[model samples]
Target: MSGGPGPGRWLTDRLSTLLVVRMALERTGAPRTAVAGALRWMSPAGWAAAAAGLPATVAGRHLGWAELVVAGAALLAVLAAALVFTVGRQPYGVDLRLSSARVVVGERAVGAVVVRNTAARPVLPARVELPVGTAEVAFPLPGLPRGGEHEEVFAIPTARRAVIPVGPVRSVRGDPLGLVRRAVSWTQVHELYVHPRTVGLASGAAGLLHDLEGRPSSDITASDLSFHALREYIAGDDRRHVHWRSSARTGTLMVRQFEETRRSQVVVALSRHEADYGDPAELELAVSAAASLGLESFLEEKDLTALTTHEVLPAVSRGALLDALTRLETAGGPRGFVAMARAVSRDLPHASLVVLVCGSGVPVRDLRAAGAVLPAGLRAVAVRAHVQDEGVASVGGLTVVTVAELDRLPRLLRRAVR
Candidate 1:
């Protein structure tokens, strides 16, 4: 046997023994009811006297009434002190504050939790637990002064894009004797929304034709003049193109051939309608195609605008247009493709390209009705599955591109514009 116990070993052993005794008492019928009955049967002094008399009875030794009275008084004093400490020593309040209630993806977010001592006396908190997403963290508060606050910062991880929910913090206070612990829960909730990541594409889509052009070929034609490039004049070239300034410096003539700038303007219409399970994939493909076309046009420096039935209209700029598309990914509502197209045609310039990205379930009559209102030169391309009968033959002098044949959109667009 060991001659002496290690630090805190004696205290630990005492607590273990007390727990076992408490559990044993509890298992014998209803311990709480029994304790209540015991308390009712005798006064504190009478209970103390009974406890003091038990030792002598077990030892079969004679004990005087005066000695028993003194022993009982001493035991009562200790019990009274324990009752006071158990009730008045524990601390019981917690508060949490986040630097920002909302956060974006890939951003560093921080929060602080404050533990307060509501009791009049000091308390040693065993542990405080905070819930974050699918995990939980526990922190220790060795000692907290009465009416004082302890603050700690917690870091939020940025591994994925999503909405994260934080907390209903919990605090646990253990008895000084380490035999009993009390737990309390707090109500606090925080929300964070993570945005999507975007990568820029270097290739331009200016040369690619859009179905909204209402033309038949992908070749570039010389109808409109937009500045293309300046090059050195070659042999057999017209001398009228010679630049006197350039001849004076390098003795070379620089001629400018303005590249034909197409008059085609593109309008991308995104339907905000909710699709059924069978058509969700098709709908997503349509949306991606529309976004790709819009981005390509913007990069090529083509005039383009995007509209959604869900209250988003991005200017012709690439960034603003992309942001609109990103929002369209989670949009919900009824199909406003026909109505949106009619509005765009009426408000925008004539001969513009109207590209409608819609689900397969739109009524063909609505498409035909919209087609009648569009300008003579304006072209439309409706994207949907072939299964859903969109009875639309031609809308606003535009052509419909079935879901199965969507791959030919680039070529179709070039022809439409020509």
Candidate 2:
């Protein structure tokens, strides 16, 4: 969100820059393979020792012969160990396992890596580097005898909601001299989803249901099952549906009228376009809103359908919904929210309700227009994920709620029923 775009895109862009640098090194005959990959870097101690030894080796000849001999020997020893460390084969059969792949904000999670020595002889101590998002952690491994395994546990950060890439663990090997280092990646990449915090809307379920089901709109016609009221019989009216009491009293026929009713289904249309979200805070708020509202709808057992700029998320169960929401990142889609609205209008014309969770950059007029495009009698509610002093209001004839955060959504939802 800060550098280029979303986290994934920013990571890709950063890695591209690193790749360009590595490619230049490879062009100059640097090794790109694991055996002699250029991923290695000299530690501070290595650089300092080399710099000191070079001058001592040069000036010691004129100053003192003993100084010259000692400095040259130390330099040779350091270089010899560095070369040996670079040539040494890394420990094999390393495996990384995580406690869980999905969690909420402020929760704790752990990752364990098992280092195995499959060589015939004892494997020397080595270093392990694990990638977590844009950062890496390096820890030391104890020497392991052949066929022995050692496991190390590390804490994963869950201070915020994000999809943290956990692994592709790399093993580092270097001598005590800290001269040349070699790293070989052994494990595959795994992602952890730190979902945003959400509040349960269990108490507000009735309000949501009433809005979805209770209506006296003329836009909806009576189906065979849902009865409304009786009115004077019109031409070609079915006599079988005529009311005998009203006809006998007034000498006029009255037919039974009904209001159309279908199985209650709610569509949650979330705008995930990066432009729509505007900023990181707005993006997070928008996602939280979607999650909370969708969960409440699902808890109420209404047929819930979730739509994003990318596609419709599976709402079959809570697990599926949370997983889908956790993976929802901002994107710059080719089409905007209007396109998504059109899609919903055309495909879900019979949906009893539609909720649009928009971001900061989205205009209220545009959302109102989007809601206006829905089929007749299909109520539309717009929720803006932005900082606001007022909780709810009407905009452009469409009901809109401006929420500063996700926790206020339930109150506004309940109030909407009034």
Candidate 3:
């Protein structure tokens, strides 16, 4: 440092170099970013052609070879032509509408896409892409004049229950060789719910002592619908509940002492762990069974709580319940149904009845364990979704049934209750 320059001079020199580099980058930053974006649009073949053509063109001019120059020039011309297809900005207005946002598993999800030209001039024909779940469907859109509209109706296949994403409809522009491509999305994504099939249950199929008035519990209350024993009137007791006949007989003011009445609240827990099902289709059967039970409770205006092994589903309304079921997915690993039952017992201590939905492959020991974890005296039913062996049996303080079909669910429940 002493031979070349002082320490201060060396520091100044380093600062000057950094400043020069920063100025250079600031001047070229936009152009570099633009070039990088353009490179992203180039396909593999286009990149290869450019890679070879640039070198060949420079070598040909230095070596005085005309053939090399002509070959490189032709290759570059093809690229330039492909680039023309992607040069313009897309001028389009699109609206995606679904015939019905929700449908059953076997039903079709019908939708229509209306596209209009928003520019003053005619727009060229393009390919429109619609992403449906993991797959994409393409439609050929004809050229439209200014202010013209085009409508295309399509149906999505719904072979099973699921929430399928059906859009973010995008228009694609590319050359025949696919050297350069551009796409612009026109609409937001929409969800199509394919709900599980459900079967109606008998009025008294499931719940705790099904009574239209209300089921009576051990806890006594001052005023309720169900009639209980009368007690000496408390200081704050309402005068309307004064039992005149009881008071006259007992020679004292006695108010109606009533048991706490509560409406039937049902809890349905569907086991989604992979180990519970021998075949993947068995999980579907389990879901249908659970859905049927929950939907029945929902339609009857019974308080319902539906859950899977991993998460809880909406049970507020019929549509919300079905929509949540459509989005349910199975989990992997060695988890058992006992966790779900324990959760029901913990979270919904006042639940009147608990329905355990599981596949046939679930061990009987696990089912017994699941029932054991519930609160004492809580009514429990285990619905084992079986492929063929369908019947009803009794476990320790728990009723167990095997259902082979959705139509058999109501009958199975009736049998379990009996």
Candidate 4:
């Protein structure tokens, strides 16, 4: 005898059909109770009896009242349980919080989220979806207690400076039977900032500036209140500095020689105009050269200033100068080299050393135009590379040094300063 159908396969097929019908009803926003009621009356027995009624011989006796009633009652009980579970499940919500809204580049930052069950009963959220930039992390909140909170820490990458916005964490709650799921969004926003990276060159490279020009090679030049060195009194020596105490003790006139101290002012200007090579690498090289020169000058105890075309005032301190260089790496505008040079010249101290870091092929006319306006006694050095012109010569009152490679910058700078 051939069996009509396997019980397991029959149940699976019926479940699939019921699922399809439920989805169709849901799409049309039909009442779930009405759909459930219709499904309860559509039992296997009803289908079988309907088929039997189609045959001519069994048309009159195919279906009986008892079997239809029993099968219909059983389906109604199953559907009643499903409906109770679906409507009785609790709802959940999530909220995210951040410690700080703004942060500096290269600094660590933190973010936390709290999950709460707003419904009267507890809910076991099966999964949670978070929009965490380029990647999604799904959390399993299987036993989320009512009004409970969960916290997590994520590392923020700050290789560059920018503003970042972080989420409205979404909570996904599933029914106990896993037959239905619901999602809810929370109102939560966070902002993070990454501060710039700074290098400490004050103490690391302090000794590299010994024996430089324009300053006496003594660290304690300013501490001359104490006796420094005894020397023969020469004409025009200060009368107050006759050293009478020392002269009387030694039976001879003596004079005190104080340490010599002088201040050297240095002005560093960067050409912000687009390079001839049409590449950013050359611009970066120019910025790095400017920074290196400023730091070196400061290390030598010289008052250093960094100027760009867009700004009227130049940066004075080493840190401020470096920040200015960072800004120049991203700045774009028309060629204002002559304007910047003239501006710097007006404000620069007399007898200062002016260093111009520019790309090659800059109109010699522009350099000559600015040089004509420079203050008298100011020594100017122009650091230019072959990036624009193949053959170049020295400009008026300026020493022209060309760089064919980036590695030669340090050497070129050393020569220019000397």
Q: Which has the greatest TM-score?
A: 3
Which of the numbered candidates is closest to the native, going by highest lDDT? 3
What RMSD value applies to candidate 1? Answer: 21.1
Kindly report which residue pairs in candidate 3 clash with one another: none
Tens-digit lDDT string for candidate 2 (80-190)? 667677676775898899899888988998999998998988988888999988898888888889898989899888887778998899988877766767778898999
Q: Residue 367 of model 4: what lDDT?
A: 74
In candidate 4, which residue ranges exceed 4 Å CA deviation?
Answer: 1-262, 274-277, 312-317, 329-334, 385-393, 404-406, 415-418
Worst 10 residues of 4 by lDDT: 198-207
Candidate 1 structure quality by residue, lDDT tens digits, 1-418: 7579876999999999999998887787586785564355344554454576565444333445566555655555544443443343345677777777544446787888887878888876557778887788778876777787888789877554445677877775543443334445775677544433322223323433333343333433323244344568888767665666866787677865554434567777777676411365555555556766677667656677777666647765755554555445445565565677777777775535666766666676766776676766554666554433323344445566554333444544444334
Give the C-alpha miss distance for residue 197 in model 1, angstroms: 10
Per residue, candidate 3 scores C-alpha lDDT tens digits across 1-418 of: 3387889999999999999999999999999998887778789988887888888888889999999998888888888898898888779999999998888989877899999999999999988999988998889889999999999998898898888898999998888898887788999999888898877776436443354337688998888888888778878889999989989998999888788998878888899888888787788888888888887777677888898888888888888887887777778877768888888888999888888989987888888888889999888889898887788898776689888887887777776666
lDDT value, candidate 1, whole model: 0.59
**In model 2, how many backbone clashes occur?**
2
lDDT of 1 at 305: 70
Q: After superposing candidate 1, which stretches have Cα over 4 Å from the reference?
A: 1-264, 275-279, 316-319, 329-335, 385-396, 404-418
lDDT of each: 0.59, 0.78, 0.84, 0.60
